[model samples]
Target: MILFGRLRMLLLRTIAYLVDSFILFILVIAGFQCFLLILGLHPFIGRHLYSITGNELHLWLFFSVTIPVYMYYVTMFNTRAQATLGMRAVRLQIQTPGRMGLGKAMLRASVMLIPWEATHVAMCYPKPIWIDNQLQSPLFYTALGLTALYWLLPLLNLNEKSAHDWITGTNVIQWQVPTSKKP
Candidate 1:
């Protein structure tokens, strides 16, 4: 099987992330449209998405969709197909030394969510809807700061492994597929 070099791996992974992010963006929009429409609050969300951001129901819906949506794409896809749609398109697969189990696949996916969740929280820190007080604690900033390191983890290694990889003992690699070429 052909293995992807560092540059190739990083490029494919970045493309996969962009594709997957677009997919999530579409899903979030559709979900919000349907949910608000059902609640008959469509008028409230007529032009501004910000209208719903502070709504408790909207927050609930967002979290509900966010966790399962991401976990499904990351964990279920990795567990079942060994790759997500974007990763499949790029011919990248998640590999482990032994038979990859559901738990480990799930852990790998969850670990990858650290930066995403942290960034979300950091952005919302000023908003008092989630809590009465602004979340400006040192611990909060520290967690967000760690995400910076998490993102840079891949740069430190030649194999292009990330913090999530080191945490879960999983590797993202190129998957070999037969290509047809006519002579």
Candidate 2:
């Protein structure tokens, strides 16, 4: 029974994180593209900017967006004791074993923001020459597969050892607000 409860919590947390990430990703991409347009770097389709510039500008954009997003995710998870927008909606929070702290949150964010994930995204360029042949399609696929597996790790908490929980030494538990007594 305890194990099942933990598993349910983990699944909920994962779902919340995914939902938040998807929304944030879309928003960030759109915002960045808009910024580019304002600066006269517009590409016809949002996803084709890299192809148009031999991936030079694409790399710049990825780094620019990733750093701040990572900082925000880690800081919030560590200090405010919540996942980003998505996690909060589902009432899930990332916390350390005793109390959440900045160190743990930063660690979690660092691992989550592995460079390979960003590099794989850069691999989607239609022109093969844009990226090194050594890191072409196969590397991209592997990184993407790993990312999917990471997200799915929450489902493996049948015994209460979820991936995110393990990574951050934390657990996602159901939240219940305490009632206040009226004076």
Candidate 3:
């Protein structure tokens, strides 16, 4: 019975994650399209865009919007019962490993967003080069590798133990609606 329950919870969580990812993906794409449109409309705005180069403006746009959304979703949902959308859809809740608070959620989001995602991007580049004589590629690649490991922590729970849950001292629980007693 316990194993069954855990499996069900895992399935539900996976579905929720997929749904959330899809939504965020669409949002991020739309945001970038909008940014491009704006840049086309006002070329001057593009001149001030912060990027390694004008060619990389889209990367900056993606990071700017997606990171904040990711942080908000994880921090809000992981720390609280309802994530921005997933928990509410499934009627699920997140509980801290040791206690209830937003600190772990925030920390998790910060680590995943900045280091993990950035690392993945870095890995895409070939032949590192110094930017302003600074070695930035190595740092990003290292961060990417570590973040990938951290993200996989949840997968460890496939056998019923989550590294993420262990690290944050957190657990996701299924909420059962109470049946009314006979009057």
Best by TM-score: 1
Write the residue-wise lDDT of candidate 1 on 7-54 in tens digits.
567778889878877776676657656777789775545554444443
lDDT tens per residue, model 3, 18-126? 7767676676656654676767852335453233452353355445555656666666655435344766577766654454556677665554356545543553344
Q: For residues 1-183, could you state the per-residue lDDT of candidate 2 as single tens digits? A: 775775667677668768867876676767765787788775444676334553555465556667657766776786554556677788766544566777777877777666444453646444433544535466566667777766666665453545445777776665545589999
Q: After superposition, how far is residue 124 of candidate 3 from its true place, in Å?
A: 3.2
| Each model's Cα RMSD | 5.7, 4.6, 6.2
For model 2 the local lDDT of residue 69 reads 72
Off by over 4 Å in 2: 1-11, 41-58, 115-136, 159-162, 179-183
Q: Count clashing pairs, candidate 2.
A: 0
lDDT over C-alpha atoms for residue 38 of model 3: 68
Q: How big is the positional error of residue 108 in model 2, measured in Å on the Cα after superposition?
A: 0.7
Residue 124's lDDT in candidate 1: 49
1 against 2, candidate with superior lDDT: 1
Whole-model Cα lDDT per candidate?
0.67, 0.63, 0.56
Clashes of each: 0, 0, 3
Deviating ranges (above 4 Å) for candidate 3 = 1-4, 39-62, 78-82, 97-100, 111-119, 127-161, 176-183
Q: How much is 58 displaced in model 3, in angstroms?
A: 8.9
